[model samples]
Target: MNRVYILLGANIGDPWQQLAAARLEIEERIGSIELQSSIYESEAWGVTDQPVFLNQVLAVSTAYSAMECLDIALDIERDLGRVRLKKWGSRVIDIDLLYFNEEIINTERLKLPHPYIQERNFTLVPLVEISPQYLHPVLKKINKTLLLESKDTLTVKKHIHEHL
Candidate 1:
């Protein structure tokens, strides 16, 4: 089985509920969830005008290939009512493939070890919570180290309420 890390975020239409539903769909369609981080509340990363997003990181094990995992994630996003009106726009669900095992892959459709993992606290914070020692394939740094070195000024707070 290939280990994959996925980031799930939502800012529109009951984000908590949307994440919960997405988790179920992920387990059913993508892979079995091995580890899940607590939900985080963060300011919009790229676009500051949007609503704060609820984000979480999940570690999953699957027999599917990386591209297959991407396809399943997109399907889950669409099934959860995601409408990509704009880049980084508010949505009901956003499922991002963060890492696929320790492999580095760049294709027209997918990129492994998510290109932005090192730059976004919204992604690194929760990721560290669940996999602090996990090493980045390309950066050769642990998740905790990357989070500590992250320059992202955005506020990322751990949500007190449990949604995962």
Candidate 2:
């Protein structure tokens, strides 16, 4: 099985419920969830005018290829009512493939070891919570280290509730 790390985010229409539903869908469609970080609230990344996002990181073990995993994630987003009207626009759900078994892939449709993992604290912080020591395939740095070094000024606070 390939070990995959996925980042989940939502900012519209009951984000907590959307994430919960996405998790269930992932478990049913992708693979078993091995580890999950607490949800985090952060200011919008690419676009600041949008609502704060609820984000979480998940570690999954899957037999599917990376492309297949991406397909499954896209299906989950569509199922959750995601409408990509604009880049980084507010959405009901956004599921990103962060890492895939330490492999680096850059294709038209997918990029493994996510291109911006080192620069976005919204992605790094929760990732650190679950996989602090996990090394970045391209950067050769640990998740926690990357989080500390990240220059992203966006506020990322851990949500107090445990349900999501």
Candidate 3:
């Protein structure tokens, strides 16, 4: 099984419920979920004019490959009403693959260890909450340490909402 980390976020139409719904759908498709971080309330990252997002990271073991996993993630987002209007646009739900094991596979659609995972505090904060000592495949640094030194001071509040 391939160990994968997925980041979940939502900011529209009962954001917390949408996030939980996505998680339930993921469990049905991906077998079992290993670990999940507490839900966090974070200010919008790129597009500041949008609503604040509720984010969380999850650890799972799956039989699918990296690209296959990406396909599944995208499907879930679409099923949950995520529309691609613009880069960093607001969405009802967003499912991002943060890490896909140690494989460094970069294709037209997917990038391992997510291209921007280390840069955004919203992603890194909850990621470290689940796996504090996890090491990045290419960066070779602990997840928590990266969060500590990150220049992103965006407010990331823990336990923003209770998990369903």
Worst 10 contiguous positions by lDDT, candidate 3? 155-164
Write model 2 residue lDDT over 1-164, tens digit each, in one string: 99999999999899999999999999999999999999999999998998899999999999999999999999999988998899889999999999999999999999988999998999999999999999998999999899889999999999987663
Which 10-residue window in model 1 sums to the lowest lDDT? 155-164
Cα displacement (angstroms), candidate 3, residue 115, comes to 1.1
How far in Å is the alpha carbon of 33 misplaced in model 3? 0.7
How many steric clashes between backbone atoms does each model show?
Answer: 0, 0, 0
Model 3 Cα RMSD, Å?
1.2
- Better TM-score candidate (1, 3): 1
Alpha carbon lDDT of each predicted model = 0.94, 0.94, 0.87
* Candidate 2: segments with Cα more than 4 A from true spot: 162-164
All candidates: TM-score: 0.97, 0.98, 0.96
Clashing pairs in 1: none
Summarize candidate 3's per-residue lDDT along 35-136 as a digit string, tens digits.
998898889998899999999899988998878888888998898888999889788999989888777878888888898877899999999989989888
